[model samples]
Target: MTKKMTWNEMSPSQQTGVLVTGSIQLALAATAWIDLAKRPAERVNGPKALWAAIIGINFVGPIAWFIWGRRR
Candidate 1:
């Protein structure tokens, strides 16, 4: 899995799968973001201000993960 992979090596479905999964996660975070006030107390205390950070870090995590943390 460490080997670098070109887009061509991934099947059409595989490519779509990665995109759809990432998109879903992005959408969920964006949607959940709207209701920070409604956020249950637990998340507030833990992910708390962390979750409530401006959209900047919220997105940066995913991008960083994709670039530096990808299995390959």
Candidate 2:
């Protein structure tokens, strides 16, 4: 098994990359959730509850929701 690197062990660039990626993930999920909440069931392609769950699936989920889950 390989040793896991902690935040302190990460290089500055790696740390920045991680932070940026994490922020993007958080923003995407938040946006998807907000859109899902404000959008009606009829407007969404699937159940809002299911989309809400899918939104938690990191990058792919939110992107998929924006591209396919919404009726528009």
Segments of candidate 2 deviating more than 4 angstroms: none
Q: How many backbone clashes does candidate 2 have?
A: 0
Q: What are the RMSDs of all candidates, in order?
A: 10.1, 0.7
Model 1 TM-score, 2 decimals = 0.50
User: Which candidate number would show the highest TM-score if scored against the true structure?
Assistant: 2
For each candidate, the alpha-carbon lDDT, in order, equals 0.57, 0.95
The TM-scores, one per candidate, come to: 0.50, 0.95
Best by lDDT: 2
Clashes of each: 1, 0
Tens-digit lDDT track for model 1 on 1-72?
599778899999989998998887777556545555565654343454554554335566434433432233
Q: Summarize candidate 2's per-residue lDDT along 1-72 as a digit string, tens digits.
A: 999999999999999999999999999999999999999899999888999999999899999999999987
